[model samples]
Target chain A: ELGPMIVTAAIGQDTSLEDGDILVVTQKVISKAEGRIVDLRTVTPSERGLKLSIETERDPRLVELILRESKSLIKIDSERGIIIAETHHGFICANAGIDQSNVAGEHMVSLLPEDPDGSARRIREEVAQILGVRVAVIISDTFGRAWREGQVNFAIGVSGIDPILDYRGSLDKQGSVLKTTSIAIADELVAAGEMVMGKAEGIPVALIRGYRYQPSAGGVAYLLRDPASDLFR
Target chain B: ELGPMIVTAAIGQDTSLEDGDILVVTQKVISKAEGRIVDLRTVTPSERGLKLSIETERDPRLVELILRESKSLIKIDSERGIIIAETHHGFICANAGIDQSNVAGEHMVSLLPEDPDGSARRIREEVAQILGVRVAVIISDTFGRAWREGQVNFAIGVSGIDPILDYRGSLDKQGSVLKTTSIAIADELVAAGEMVMGKAEGIPVALIRGYRYQPSAGGVAYLLRDPASDLFR
Candidate 1:
């Protein structure tokens, strides 16, 4: 029961999950379903974790979990209480996407799913089986960007559609060769989904209807740039 | 009109631009209206600009414009032909947010407004005056993230509302104290606006109604992070 569940049957009957629709599932649900929860009572903080905990003024157990989930520590801003870490899954996020909010117990926290793309694909397949419809799936997570303040929902995982709608080499309205116009449709949809699945609201899954997208095989793997190509890291 | 016109009147009458509404304006229209368009023919490439042009395999004239608009060049990926620059307004974007597509002429490229927050405030004031209603205005631009591929619309400027809805110290569904949950409402709204204003569809302005937000004094300047606080740059 802790693993991923096929939630198509549980969704409201009035809502029609149809073809050409996008099913935006929040990462919180996926993490819960995947049993990615960690109990603070069980965590044994390492020396490094304890050091960081003291530096960050956070719980040593929480710091241990963050260290376990993170591949590399990018930055530690104790004044701001923000730790930029590269998660084991290669995501650059605050605290390695280990979140303390919305869990059942106060002592427990949820980690991002290990393979979010795989998780998305499985969910998409299960939903397709139940509904007999082709729909894109996006695993959405809230993340803060480098230069911008505040956090917005981003597509941590994607399935059934290409995340990017590449308009490069395409003709603009004036027939100009378009460049630098590849739209992150998944991320945009994630942001749109957040409008419906509010932070305080319990709506974990949102149906984005009427929007059409090109079918694709891969998930959010292509969204990750090579280390050589990334200037920020 | 070579500058951004308060376009509330031009928007279709069918769409009621009402109070508590968010008007998302694409930066393309704002830049065009603000006369931020630069003629490539007129640019005289400096020695550094010319060197960067050859290294980045771009037009020297365009490189000069990029240098002029940028406060600092963050990173230059010569192999991939990408220049990550901190714009004069402190936005980290490719080519310093100088866009080539969707402009009137092939020889012309649009520059990000010197004061996008100022531009948004003026537009908001003008729109409020015309409609006799208060509304939030967001100046949106598409930007590629440091780790992720493709581009999603971001709030380059905002007016009439605080861009962030901070949920820190608030109770979650499970009564847990939520921290690190500040939502970037403006950027999320920008993404929603993109859903309505499709690229190449020529729709530049989108009116979002029914969503309530807190009225605030400042623009998107608050969204810009201090360089010392930023780890990615």
Candidate 2:
């Protein structure tokens, strides 16, 4: 059986974290605290924007923000209401990570926090100073996958944890050339935490215990693929 | 820190699974136990197969098996060495879920177990009967994602866990409706377990504890997406 649950809040201030403790803060809470919400009513849509809305099968206002956030539009399928774009951070995700859920009002949506790695670093520093123990911070959001059944939460920003486990040079039991490298450990952890922190439960945080992950100097940025090296594009 | 490690192997037999205990048997173990491995030397590559591989940039021998396994070929990318086909079980994955890794010797790979869900169910039932506790069994493999950085593991077969968590009809804190909802928790779990078990670590299975997951009556088959409803395809 799992241990008892501990609930806490940011309370407009930083809270310390401990080892084996998983911080499961909601993206909405982080955006609200960081002032990342954008008012949709204040923005104006263009003719190109209206065309994109019809092309993407999304709201015109939402498509306008998505277009602005996008550095490159990879694909747009009007029938499926799907638009894959490269974000400013070089992350290729749907809608450029612009989201309508969990905003304070109807006419507003929140963009992913600018420099999530930076946010995670700041939180880690604050928590370490207060609690005198190390902890890993994962900022998560829901994302769709290609050729999969449903959406799953994944880590957008992470600190104090190695995001990818590279096994390129390692050998399997049979000693054959094992090129199965780069496992996304951090993203999976965020998805696991989302199981307990339900979408509608108002529980923005979850504490994870019993597993110890290996520490690495490499940060979450390593998980971001360089577009030049990407063969699919 | 995590608890002590545990591992189990079914040497000539496919046994049932138990709670908190992981079966470390290889895909070859299960395939051999189920008699699914095909001896390529026994078969001949057809004239049409040779012509198609020249066009598809696929190994003729492998393509022959893939065509046999696939109900239909959805898409083919010769440049990227990818072929998306619908498997007999109606799964649309790369190469019809035929893998070329971790097999017995050179020039041999394994087809996905004939009945993955049934295999998982049988293993779960037998393991429970032996150890007297419920356990989740996942048959995993590495698959590349379209428009993503690196390959991640996904559950090709699963038991004793709900592959997708449906949150439809649920309301957010602000009373907003959640439409088009479900979380693919089991696939995420399989991916997470791969992080620790790893391809080269000789840890084919890792016992996970301290995480509580609710099972669904539909089991892992519920996670399979219908081709008509798949937006990305």
Candidate 3:
């Protein structure tokens, strides 16, 4: 499996990533390395899957796979072929992140890693052991946003850096208490990396240097909102 | 009023931006230069504004301004004092992009420009005229997303770049057609810029180079989804 060495090789040895540097890794490579691939042909449609398949006009096998991967169905637009769902890992995306693009075979589709936060932690530790440099790691995935037209990369998992920059008690330039001003740095970094690691391009890893962030031991779980607090959902 | 000259002065004369360079500018500066500031003291609360103010537990004057600026109210969490609104320009943001921070006085607040796309166009034209260089411009603002915790910067306005890199008919590495793989480069670029442009940091502008994007004559309006097509509002 490709690791930090892959990043070093791509960026060249001349450029060394220092402490506080963040590494944004796309889900494609991580999924491939983790063997999260599923064979669509192997899936058998359940009763629910059969009903959903008829309504959505999709393959029963694919529908079965979606049901297996998802914890709950968030939104389903049968006419438009859109099925937004929350995966078992609490990730909300189309088809439960059952990706069909860039796979080895037509019948193969990639699923998100079982524990992306654990995946991120392992990568961060492995890279640190190899390079002797402490760095934050972020696993990114492209997901469509509500009320917004296009899809943007978000942090499906994070390690080392504080996922949220809380400015609750901080005073603004006007000397007012900054409430409701926590910044999602992980998602922002992922989006930044997407600028370099294009969708069609083979580059799945990006190193961000010169930016400062608070280092902490946490995962992307903290980035998710509680259902009670989430009014839009 | 800060333009390309300011960027050159900061980065130095030895450096030069090449073709395919994208400029990510924060909406704060654009709003300030365009005189989008509103004095809370001068705003008179309308009947609807007064009722919404009491419900949201916010200042009546501010609510009045918000009501005047917004085309529709999306969500109102009265207990949380959060009001989600869609501005007249079709931007969905907190209080219609009204900000109390980074301003000169406590009474002074800034609203989003009447036409952010137009503002981006003007800034792009001005910078191009000054430097005689072609560059895509994106105006960004911090926005809270539904189902996600914390806020990330989004492209409220854009010019020159194609905004979306659609890969519907493109063939993947596996020789399969990429059906649903449009990348939102504008929003991603904006989020990337947020890394360099910290919330408290005064660096409102960021220069992104080396990435190639299709040049186009369009605004951010094209990036918006039609209400008929949008299942999530």
* Top DockQ hit: 1
- Per-residue lDDT of candidate 3, residues B1-233 (tens digit): 55655446545845565456788888888888889898898888999999999999999999889889898998899998888888887888889889887777879999887787777777678667777777788899999988788999888888888888787888876778888888778888888888778776657788888877888888887667777887777
After superposing candidate 2, which stretches have Cα over 4 Å from the reference? A1-26, A54-58, A206-221, A224-233, B1-29, B52-59, B73-84, B131-136, B207-214, B217-221
- Model 2 gets an lDDT of 0.67
Instruction: DockQ winner between 1 and 3, please give it.
Output: 1
lDDT at position A201, candidate 1: 72
Model 2 misses residue A135 by how many Å?
Answer: 3.5
lDDT of 1 by residue, B11-57 (tens): 54555566788888889988888899998999999999999999989
Query: What Cα-based lDDT does every candidate model obtain?
Result: 0.83, 0.67, 0.83
Ranking of all candidate structures by their TM-score, best first: 3, 1, 2
Q: How many residue pairs clash in each candidate?
A: 3, 2, 0
lDDT for each residue of candidate 2 in A76-182, tens digit (9 for 90 to 100): 77888988887786667778888766565788788877877776666666666665667777777787776678887777777777777666777666777766456
- Name the top TM-score candidate: 3
| lDDT tens digits by residue: candidate 1, A1-233 | 31124353344456666778888888998998889998999999999999999999989999999999999998898876678898887888888998878889878889999999888888778767777777788999999888888899988998898988888888877778776688888889999887778887767888788877888998787777777777777
TM-scores across all candidates? Answer: 0.92, 0.81, 0.95
- What's the candidate order when arranged by decreasing DockQ? 1, 3, 2
